[model samples]
Target: MKNFAYTRAGSLSAAAEAASAEGADIIAGGTTMVDLMKIGVRNPDALVDISGLSELEGHEIGADRIRLGALARMSTVADDPDVIAAFPALSESLWKAASPQLRNAATLGGNILQRTRCPYFRDTAYSQCNKRNPGSGCAALDGGETTLHAIFGGSEACVAMYPGDLAATLVAFDATVATRGPGGTRTIPFAELHVLPGDTPEIETVLEPGEIVTAIELPVVPAMRASHYLKARDRESYAFAAASAAVGLEMDGDTVRDVRIGLGGVAAVPWRATAAEDSLRGSPLTEATAREAGRIAFADAQPLEGSAYKIALGADVVAGALLQAKSRMGGE
Candidate 1:
């Protein structure tokens, strides 16, 4: 890793100011940023540490929504009784991520902002990763290992997946992100936080330079209490998902009254499977109907050779998650 000057910001405004400078990057938990720096994917000249900013600490569960402070530790949120009861999918996503040690140290904002685990992008030896170097071309597309590449939201230039668990649940529940920057504070739809890998693959998120995510707001609804997150991975723990689904279902006497589906490990972003939700909104909640909805979710998938299986796997994940959500409707 390149040597960099570090400054612990006293306040959110200070952190934003320091991060706005050229060649500067924000560090909170340092879980993801430090890893990228060591791999030469990130080489900032200055590090603005926001871990001490008090404004970004703690969480509040209110009647209307749950406000999760950006600096809230993953373990802390995962263990919150209110979160586990009302937003079980969020809690499950956090607990299922990384390991116990990482959950103790990693913050919610850093988790959402974490970079992709694409091998081509991480190894600088391969000079064809567009996400690492714009216009360099994507090695993953040119006969490279594409088992973890995206099936949706991939342009010809890039096909890397987002690779996060919590964001999938957040997107399914219509969460919003709050940010403070040099231009002041603003709220953004959680789904809009990560941008598609269009022609410019290096630019990942819509967050501006020096903008610090302050909090994540999730609306409380009846369906969210019955939500579930199912992650299919190479291993049981401390592994990135191969395919996952975050689903929330509101049933009306075995019929779907409302449903929300978010797909992970299969897209460039935490994909909201609106088509799948629409397909099952009024249908009976059954294995056949759920499976059909899952198929509809992946109907427009554009998968590479090694990633074609993700289309089927992701679909099954969605179906399973929906059934699991349905089972939890009133039993929780």
Candidate 2:
């Protein structure tokens, strides 16, 4: 809603150069950025419209990885034959996000970079939100039931979950994010993109001020076809998840070979379940094993006062997702 200067970038350097000024922000689809600005949470003196840079578009599925240009549209990736056949979890995750209209305009990079939807984080109507204004104190504690708050990797200062549907799937797939910045281009594991709100909840990602997202890369996942992403939200449409899981499995007959699990809605980040995957690897794909894997995923979860239900819900989400993924694998 605030008046601001806007300019398009010709290339990656141009984008970074345009965004180098203090209080400057990049606009891809302008979905989350514009929303944050409307709430007065973001006040960019200049808006670098990177949407015009065709250099940051398209994807290439190579022998070992899929290179995703930062500007590749969500709808385009969701419908790609290779992504559909191989990275079913990635494709399903995108299609299951926002509305079709939103997906049409939303880029893969933008989807992963979307901000948390915590009431305290997004509501400018509220006077105190540590995320919007650090050290202001979180009102969700005494004000209302914060059932949607994070359960993992939260400090006493903040408990807002990192909210994005596609991001969870990307982390599970071991995706890497490429960025071009003031220093030079750098690659970071997608799982390392988000930083916990230890003291500063205002800063979400590790990208430098002048760093522009270039691409996201996913290494080959042979078990990707035997994958699934499921969300238990308030409704079947136009909603964020309440509890969700992204799962992929490789098997030798009924014996699990490799398993990857990632959870959303319960963590400050898209939480990769190393314990659950370890429990399932080299084990028989039975209901009991699946249940154990799910439970192990939440063994270290620390829930808030009013949101203990997430531990059980998160476990069930992982279990259900594993079962569904195995069923699909059986069919294959």
Candidate 3:
């Protein structure tokens, strides 16, 4: 890593101000930031340590909502009894992400802000990654290692997938992100936090410079008790998802009362399958209906030569997740 000035911010205000400095980056769990720094993908001249800020260190689980501190470790959230009981999708997402050691060190805030696992973006050896270097051109589109690339939200500029598990489940649950910036604190829908590559792949997020995420807020989701997150990968442990689904369903006997679906490892952002949810609403929760919902979810997919298989794979993943979630609703 490059030599950089380090300072610990005593308060959120102080952290915000410090983060505004040129090439200054915030360091919380240091899982994503440190790895990017070491790989030369991110070379911040200054790192503002915010891990000591007690204001963003714990969680608040209420009957109506759940507020997860940005600094809360992934393992901590996964192991919380309240989270496990009320939000099974959220708990499962964290538990299935990364490895046990990484889960213990990764923070909720950092995980959402984590960059794409695109090899071209991480290895500076590639000279054509638009995300790493704007207007430089994207090699992944023509390079042929696109099995892991996006099939839903891709443009000519970039096709990289957003590699985040928690954000997918949070999007499924209609979560909001709390952030502190130079102007003050504000809350935005979690879905809007990540921006599509479009023409400007370099600008990954909507956050203004110097803004630091404070917490992730999830509204009370009664159906979330029957939710589940299932990931399909090449191997089991320590492998990134090829396609994953976070699904929540509320059933009244055989009919679907409510539904939420979020897809991962197949889009530029955490994808909420609203159309799929609409199709499944008020319908019987049967295997055929679930499969149809999954197929409808990928109606707009623009698949590349190598990643076309993901459309079918993604459909099956979503359908299986829906069935799994429904099974959890037994006796409820």
Candidate 4:
């Protein structure tokens, strides 16, 4: 890694201000940032450590809404009694993510802001990645193996997927991301925090230059307790998702009353499957119906050579997650 000056910030505002300066960045868990720095993908001259900022450290797992501190470790949130009881999908997403060691070290905010795991983008040896170098070209699309590339919300310039599990579950529940920037503190819908990989593939999120995420808030809802997260990967442990789904449903006599579905490992952003929700809402819950809903979720997915199989795998995973969620509705 490059030699960088580090200063621990006393407050979130101070950290934000320091990070606003040129060649400065914020370090939370140091899992993602440090890895990128070591790989030469990111080289910040100065790093403002926000791990000690008290304002960004606690959880409010209340009856009305759950507020998760940005600096809260993934393992802490996953083990919280209220989180496990109220938001199974949220807890499951974290538990099924990276290994236990990583979960203990990684913070909630850092996980959401994690960079793509695309080989071309990570390895500086490849010179054709547009996300790493804007307008350069995408090697993955040009005869490069793209089994893990995005099929939805991807432009020709970039096909890399947003490799995170927590954000997918948060998006499914319509969580709000609270941030403090130069202007002031504000809350934005979690869905809007991540941008689609359009022409500007390099710009990943809606967070302004000086903005620092403070917390994530999710409203307590009846459906959330019955939610479940299912991931399909090549290996059982320490493997990225090949296709994953976070599903929550409110059922009325075997019929769906309301539903929320978020798809991961298949898109540029944490994909909220609105069409799938539309298909399931107010409809009888069955294998056939769930499969149809899954198909609707990927109606707009444009797959490349190696990723074409993901379309079918993603649909099956969605269907399975819906069934799993429905089975858990009895407890709620």
lDDT of 2: 0.86
Superposed model 3: Cα runs more than 4 Å off: none
Estimate, for each residue in 182-274, the C-alpha lDDT of model 4 and write its tens digit. Answer: 778999999999998888999999988778999999998888988999999999887889899999988888779989899999999999999
After TM-score superposition, the amount by which residue 236's alpha carbon in candidate 3 deviates from its true location, in angstroms, is 0.9
Once fitted onto the true fold, the runs of candidate 1 whose alpha carbons sit more than 4 angstroms away are 330-332
Candidate 1 lands at a TM-score of 0.98
On TM-score, the stronger of 1 and 2 is 1
* Predicted candidate 1 versus true structure: per-residue lDDT over 199-313, tens digit per residue: 9888889999999999999888878888899999999999999999889888888678889998888889889999999999887988899899989999999999999999889
lDDT tens readout by residue for model 2, 1-332: 77889888878897898798897989999878888898887888899989988978998888788899999998898889988888788888888888998989988888888888888777787767888888888877656558888889887778888878888798888999999998899999989999998888778889988898889998896778799998888889879888789999989877888888988888888789998999998889888888898899999988877778888888888999999999887632
Q: Tens-digit lDDT track for model 3 on 271-296?
A: 99999999999999888999999999
Model 1 alpha-carbon miss at residue 246, Å: 0.6
What are the C-alpha RMSDs, in order, of all predicted structures?
1.2, 1.4, 1.2, 1.4
Clashing pairs in 2: none
lDDT of each structure? 0.91, 0.86, 0.91, 0.91
- Deviation from native of the Cα of residue 198 in model 1, angstroms: 0.8
Of candidate 1, the 10-residue stretch with the lowest lDDT total is 323-332
Question: What does the lDDT come to for candidate 3?
Answer: 0.91
